[model samples]
Target chain A: MKEDPFAIKVENVSKKFSRNLRRSLFLGTLDLAKSFVNLPPDTTKLRKSEFWSLRNVSFEVKKGEIFGIIGENGSGKSTLLRLIAGIFPPDDGRIVVNGNVGSLIAVGAGFHPHMTGRENIFLNGTILGMSRSEIKAKFDDIVKFADIGDFLDAPVSTYSSGMKVRLGFSIAIHRVPEVLLVDEVLAVGDISFKRKCMERMEDIRKKTSIIFISHDMRQVERICNRVMVIDKGKELYTGETLNAIDFYYKHTIAKEVQNIDPKLIVYESTGDIYNITLNITNEKGENTEIFKHKEKIVFEFNFESRSEYQNPILGLDIVSPEGITITSLKNVIFGHQRPSIKVGHNNFRVILEDNSLMPGTYRIAFKWRKQDNFSLVSATGGRFAIQSEPELVPFGGYFKVKYKWIQN
Target chain B: MEYKTIYTPNQRFKVNIFKTWYIMFRNVYDYRELIFQLFKRDFLMTYKKSFLGIAWILITPLVGIVNWAFLNYTGVLDPGETTIPYPAYVLLSTSIWGLFMGFYVASSNTLNAGAGFIMQVKFPHEALLFKENFQHLVNFTISFVIIITTLMLFGVKFSFLSIFFPLTILPLFFLGSSIGLIVGVINIVAVDIGRVINKLMELLLYVTPVLFASNTENENLQIALKYNPLTYLLGVARDLLIEKNVQNLDIYLIISLVTFLIFLLALRLFYVSEDRVIEKMI
Candidate 1:
C-alpha cells in the first residue's frame, strides 16, 4: 500500500464568523471582565454570537500537489486560505503545516504608496520571510520578472495597477515557500503575464503544495490535480477536478430548480379546449434527444381549444443552470398573431433558429397569454442538455463564427 | 524503522525565555536589511515631495526654538535662574524631546500602520515595529545634526560635553522604545488604548519639563520631575548641550541602566506575544 504523501493535514476544521455586531460586543465585554478577574480565557465559548464559516471541512492535499478550491461568492473559500496561511487562527480544530507557507491573498498588500518600488521590494520580501541578503541575491530576477525597469526607483504610487501586481507577485514567488496559497490573483494580469504566472505556478507546484481558490472553473480544471467545492462553508465534495466540477454544477442546478416556485407554471388558455403537451425538440426536430451547441431548437406546445383568442402572444425563454436568463424569444418578431382558435383543438410551435449558445445544460421555459393585458395565462418548463462536437470545433464554447484568416 | 522518541505527541507548556530571546534576535538579525530599507524609505519619502526638501529637518527644530523665544520674550514662560539663552535652551530641549516624541508615535502606531503587511503576508510581525522605530532613529539623527549645526553657527561654546550627545540619545531611545513596545502591544490587543495614549501624550507635554529648566528650590515639582524618566533624558541632553560638563553624570548612569532593563523586558514580552496577538486581532 502507498503511504499518504500529504504534508499538510487539516482535521475537522470549522471556522465561524459572527454577523451580529451586538453579540460580538457582548462577548468582547465578557472576555475583558474575565481577563480582569484573572481567569483563563475561554477559547470554546462563542459568548453571545458567532456563526461558523466552515463546518467540518476536512481534506488532505499530498505534498507537491496543486489543489483547487471552487465556489461561488461568499462560499468561505477565502476564509479557508486565510486559516491555512495563519493570517487568522482557527476558532476551533487544528491545521498542521509541515513546512514554511507563503500566501498571496492580495497583491501589493503592504506596498506603501509614498515609497518606491525598490524600497517596497525589501519590505515585502522581509514580510515574506526573506532576509536582506536573500532579497539582494534575487534582486535581479525580481526586477526582470516585474519588467518595470526604470520605474522601480520611482514611487510605487506612480506605478500602474498591473505594475504593482507584477512586482508583488515577483517577490512572493521568489520567497520559495513549501506551501503557496493563491486567491484569485491570477485573473488580474494580462494574457501574456497570466500565462507566465501560470507557468511559474506549474513549475513551483512540482516542489510545493498549493491551495488555489478561484471562481473560474476552466482555470481550476486546467491546472489543479484535485478540486474541492465549498458551499455555505461546508465541504460539498472533494475529489478529482472534473468530478468535483460536475458535482458542483449538478448541486447548483438542483438547488436553483428547487428554489423556483412551482405555482408559477403557465398554461394555455383562450384557445381550443384541448390538453396541451409541451415537448423539447432538438435542431433536427428529434424528440428526447440532447441538443448540440449552435443547433436549432424549438419548444413545440400542442393544444386544442374551442375558440382562439385574437392577437395572442407566445414566448419562450432559456435559463442557464445557474438560474440566469440566457436567452428569450417571442412570436412578435416573426410577424405572427395569435389566431382565434375555433371550438376545437390546435397546435402551437415556437421555433428557435440557430441557437448559438455555449455547450452547457439549459432549462426551456414557456409563457403564453392574450396580446393585450399580457396576463401570464400558463407556463411550463423542463431541462435540456447541449453536447458540443469537439471534432467540429476547438474545445471551448459553441459560438464559433466565420472569420477571414489572413497572414501578413 | 524502529525509533525511540523522547518527545511526546502532546507536550506540556514550557516557557523558555532564553530560547525566545535567541529566536527574536536571530530573526531580527536575519531581516536586518529590511530595517535599513524601511529607514531609508521613510527618511527619503518625508522630504521627497516637499519643496523645502531636507531643510524641513532644520526648520522644525528652528520653529521650536523660535516659539520658545517668543514665549519667553512675552514672559509667558519665566526664564529660570539658568543663564542659558531661551532659544538655546528650547532648541536643546525640543530637539531631544522631538526624538522621544517621534519614537513614541512611530512605535505606538507601528501595528496599525503596518496592518497591510500583517494580514496579507507571513513574516515575523515584530520586525515592522522595529523597522518603524529604527526609521525614527534615523530622523532623530538627522534632526540632531541640524541642531548641532545651528548651535555652532550661533557661536555657542562647544566642549567635551558635546561628545556625550550620542550617549544621551542611547538612553532616550531605550526609554522611548520601552514605552513604545508596551503601548504597541496594548494597541494590538486593545485598540482603544491607542487613542488614549495619543491623548495622554499630548497632555504629558505640559507636565514634562521640555522647555523650562527645573529650579532646585521647588523641591516638590523637582522630585516629581526626577521620577519622570523623560525628564532625566531631556535634562541630560540639555546639560550636555547647554550646561556642558556641569551636568550630573551619576543620575544619568542610574537612569540609563534602569531604562535599558525595562526596555529589554518590554521587548521580550512583545516578541512572545507579537505572533499570536497579531493573528488574533487582524
Candidate 2:
C-alpha cells in the first residue's frame, strides 16, 4: 500500500466554548477542579451554556498541498485551526501533524512595545518557534522584507500598525515549518508586499503544507488545491475549490438573500418607457444568477412604449461588490442605433458573449436615456456571482481584459 | 520527552505527582530561552514608566521601616529587644519577609503578565513562572543591597552563616510560590479572591513576626507567632543571619517539610489547570 502523504490529519475533533462570562467562570472552575486530579473535562456532553465550537470535524491535508477553509463569521474555521495548532486541546478525538506546526494566527502577538524591533525579532521569533541562530541567520532578510529601514532599532511601539504587521509577517515566513497555519492576516499587507507574500508562499508550497483560512475567495481559489466549506461547526462541503465555493455561495448567501423586486424598475424620467421586466438567462434559456468565464448570458427585457422615439440608448451597468461600476453597455457602442418596435409590449434581447468579469458578486444597474437630449433615467436591481478559472484572473484589475501578446 | 504531545481530558482527576514534576521540569528546561527573554523584558519594563524607577522598591520598605522604628522609639509599641539595632532588625526581617511577598506577587502576576502570549501562542505557560521568579530575584538582590547598607550603617554584624541565606529561606520561596499559584488561579476565575487575599496577607504579615521579635511580652501575639509558619520560615532565615539562636528546630523542619508538600500539590494543580487558564484568558 502507498504511504499516506498527509501532513496534518484531524480525526473526530471537537471543542466546546462557553457562551457567557458567568458560565465560563463556573465551568472554568469546574474544569480546573476536575483537572487537579489528572482527570479530563467531561467532553462527551454539554452542560449549561457550553456549546461545541467544533464538533466531530475531520479532514486531512496532504504534504505539499495548500488547503483552504471557507466559512462565515462564527463558524468553526478558527477553532479548527487553533486545535490543529495546539493552541487549544481538543475536547475529544485526535490531531496529528507529522512535523512541527507554525502559525500566523495573530501577527506580532509576542512583540513587547518597550523592546526595540531588533529585540522583538529575537523574542517573537523564539516565541514563534525559531531558534536564536535561525533568527540571526535571517535577521537581515527579515528587516529588508519588512522595509522599515530607520525604525529597525526603534521600540516596536513606534512602528505603525502596518509596519508591525509587515515585520511580524517577515519574521514568520523565513522558516519552512512542515505545516503552516495561516489566518486572514495576509489581507493587511499592501499590494506589492501582498504580491511578494504570495510569491513567497508559492515558493514555500513546494516543501510545506499550508492551511489557509480566508474570506478572500480569489486567493483561496488561486492557491488552494482543495477547499472546505463549513457552517455552524459542521462540514458543508470538502473538496475541489470551485465546487466548494459554488456550494458555499449557493448555501450561505442564497438562504437569507432578499428577493429582487419583480415589478418594473423604472424612473419617472424614463420617458416612453412603460412597465418593464429584466431577465438574465444562460444560453439554454434557463434562469441563472451565475456565469463562468467565457460563458454566454442573454439579457432580456420586455416593456411597453407609450410613444415611439428615435434612437433610444439602452444601458446596463455591472457594479462590483465594492460598489465600483465594472462596465456599462451602451447600444450606440454596439448593435443598431435604431430598431423597429411595436408601441406596446415590446421585448428586446442582448447576448453578452465571452463574459470576463472577475470572480465576485456584481450588481446590475440599468439605465435608459434619449440619444438626442442625453438626459438619463436609472434604476439598480439584481445581483449575480461570476466565477472565472483561477488562472485567467490577473491581479491589479477589477475586470479581466481580452488581450494577446505578440512576439515578432 | 516526546516531540509530539497529545492533549485530552484528565478525566477522574488522579494526582500524578511524579509525572507532573517530570513534565514541569522538562518543559521548563526546554523553554528556558523564552523564560530568559521574558525575564529580560519584564526586568527592563517594570521601572521604565515610574518617575523614581527601581528606587521605589527600596523606598517603600525604607519608609515602612522608619514608621515602625518611630513607633518603637516613642514607646507606642514594644517590639521587644533585638540583638541588632532596631532599624536594621526591622529592615532585614521585612526584607526577608519581602522575599516571600515578592515571590507571591511575581507568581500571582505570572498568568496575567503572559495573558497576551497565552491567548494567541502555543507554548508551555508555566515557563512564565520561571521568568517571574527570575525577575523578582533581580529586584530582591537590589533590595538586599539596601539591607546590607542599612545593617552596616547601624553597626549590625552578620554571622558567618549569612552565606547560607538562599538555602535558609528556601521554604519561604516554596511557600510563596505555592500560595501564589492557587491565588493566581483564583484571581483569574474570581478576581475578588485577589482583594480578599490582599486583606488576608495583611493579617498574615502581622502575625508572622517580621516587624517584631518573636518573644514579645504579649501572650496572644506570641501564641499567634508560634503557630505561624513564617515564625520558622522567615524567622530562622533572619535569626541565622543576625547571630541569634535557632528556635524550635523540630517545628521549623516540620513547617519546611509541610511547605515542600504544599509546593508539590500546587505544582500539580497549576500544571493541570493551565488549559482552563488559557480558556479564561481568551
Candidate 3:
C-alpha cells in the first residue's frame, strides 16, 4: 500500500437498493447466477422495486478537511456516507478512502442490554477499531467523559437513551481515527455534552478528516470547512461552507415566502379614525413580504385621514418575538425634516438597504400619537418575516448584530 | 499498515485468493482480544438474569441425558444395545451431537444478531461469527465434564486413544460451521432459509445415529445413515473413545477432506460477498 495525500475521493458513485425482501432475494439469485458465468450485472437498468439512491456523485477531501453534507431527510446523504465508509459498494463509479475510517453513523449500536456500561465501553470501543490495550488505557477517561458516574457498573438496559449515546459517542471519538464519519449522532446528547462534543471535534479536526452530515445548519456552518448540498440524490452545490448554505436557503427556505398581509396583533383607537395599508417589496423588485438576509426591502405605507389632526406623530416599531422593540422610528424622536401630510391621502416609503434582522417573524406596529398627552390612533400595522442565510448560531432569537470577541 | 486507496465499485481488479485469505486471517488475529471480549459478553448476557448463571450450561445437557435415560431404561425407546451401558451411550452421543448443533445454530444466527453492529461499525465482521463459535465452545467444554463423569459411573475403561477425542470433534465443528456460513449468508436476504434449516436440524436428529446405534437390519435406514456425514463423524468419535477402534476410518477420512474443502469455499464466499449482503440487510 502506497501513501495517498487525499483522505477521501469519491468518483461518479451511485447506489441502488431494493425496497422489499422478495425482490431482493430474486435479484440476489440472478446476480449469483450471472457471477458464475462471469457476467457483471447491469447497474444502469432498474428492475422492479429497485431505485437508485445516489447518482454520479464526485468529490475529494484533503487529509485534514472537515467536510459537511446538508440535505433534508431522504436526500441520500446517509447513503453517500455509507458508501464512503465502505459499508457497501457503490453500484457504479469508485470511492477511494486512504485511511482508517471510524463511523458514528448510529450511536450506541451493538450495545448489549445485559452488559454494564463499563463492559459496553470496551465492546463499543473495539467495534470502532480501538485495540484492547488502547481501550484499557482510555477506560477511565471514557467513563469520565461519559459522566455516567456510579451507574457505570449498572447494566446498559437500566440507562436512558441519552446515557447510552453519551457512552457510545465518547468511545467513538476516543478511537482517534484518521477519517471520521458523523451522521446526526451528536443531536442525541444534551446541550452541555453537545458543546463538549463540538470542542472535541474541533480538536480532532486538526489531525483527522471528517465527513459530517446534519440537518442542524448552524452546527455545519460552525465547524465544516466545506459543505455539499444534496437534494433528491443529486448534488446541488459543493464549495465554500457559506455559499452552500446560501444556496440551500435560497432554494428551500426563501422560495417559501408569500406576499400576504401581516396579521395584526394589537389594535386600540379612541377618537380619530385612519385607514392604513402596508406593502413590502423584495430586492428582486417583486412585491414580497419575505426577504433574504441583508437584502434591500422597501416598506410602503398608505394612509387616509377622516378628520384633520394637529401635531400627530406617525411612529413605526419593529418588535421581535420576545416583545423587545428592535428599532423604532418616530418623527419627533429624530431631528425633524418632516414631509407635509394632507388630510385626504398620504404615502410614506422607507427603504432599508441592509435589512439585517435575523431569520424569523417580526411584528411592525404603527401608532399615531398626538402631541401633549393625547393619543389619536395606536394599533399594530403588519408583520413581515425574514429568511436569513444559514449562520453558526441558529435559533438565537431573531436578533443579528455585528461584533467580534476579544479576550483580555 | 500504510494507507491505501480502496475503490468502491466492483471492478476487474483481480483479488489474489491467497492474499485475501492472509489478510482476513491477519485481521482476525489482530482482533483476537476483541473476539474474546465479545464472547465473554455473549456468555454473560445469555444467563444474566438467571439465578443459575454459568451452571445452566452443564445443567441443560444433564437434564437431556436424564430424560433420555429414563425412556431407554423403561424400554419404551430402545436405542440398539451398545457394548457400553445405555445411559452412557445416550449421554456421550447427546453431548457430541449438542456441540455440533450448537455450532450450526450459532453460525447461522451470528450475523443477524450482530446486524446492529454491522450497520453502525466498521470492523472485521467475521470476528462476530468467531465470537459466537467461541461462546458455544465454552459451553460445550463445561458440559463435556458431565460426559466424563458418566463414563466413570458406567465402569467404562478408557484407552490412551481418548486423548485424541477432543481433536476428533474439531472437524465436526468445522463441518457444521461450513454449512452455517453458507446458510447464514443466504438467510440475510431470504430469511426463510434459516427457518428451513432449523426444521431440517430436527429431522436430522432422528436420521443420524445420535440417540441409537446403527441397525443394519433396517437396510433403508442404514443406507440413509451410511451417506449422512454425521453418521461417520459420530461413529468415529464414539468408537475411538469407547470401543477402542474406529469402525469406519476410511469413510471418516474421506468426509474430513470434503469438510475441509467446504470450509474453505464457505469462508471465501463469506469474505467476498459480505459487503453486498450487508447492503441488502440494511
Give the TM-score of each candidate.
0.76, 0.84, 0.81
Clashes of 1: 20
Tens-digit lDDT string for candidate 2 (B74-132): 76554348887665677788788888998888888878877666766788777988789
How large an RMSD does model 2 have?
4.8
Q: Give each prediction's root-mean-square deviation over alpha carbons.
A: 7.3, 4.8, 6.4
Interface RMSD, all candidates in order, equals 6.6, 2.8, 2.2
Query: Model-by-model lDDT, in order?
Result: 0.70, 0.78, 0.77
Query: TM-score: which candidate is best?
Result: 2
After superposition, which runs of candidate 1 have C-alpha atoms over 4 Å from their true positions?
Answer: A1-4, A14-16, A20-40, A114-123, A131-155, A254-313, A319-408, B1-15, B67-80, B216-223, B244-254, B272-282
Give the fraction of native contacts in model 3: 0.60
The residue-by-residue lDDT of candidate 3 on A149-211, one tens digit each, is: 888999999998889899989888888888999999988889999999999999998879999
Q: Number of clashes in model 3? A: 0
Residue pairs clashing in model 2 are: A37-B13, A37-B14, A39-B10, A39-B11, A39-B13, A40-B9, A40-B10, A40-B11
Worst 10 residues of 3 chain B by lDDT: B8-17
Model 1 misses residue A405 by how many Å? 23
DockQ of each: 0.21, 0.42, 0.40
Number of the top lDDT candidate:
2
DockQ for candidate 1, C-alpha atoms: 0.21
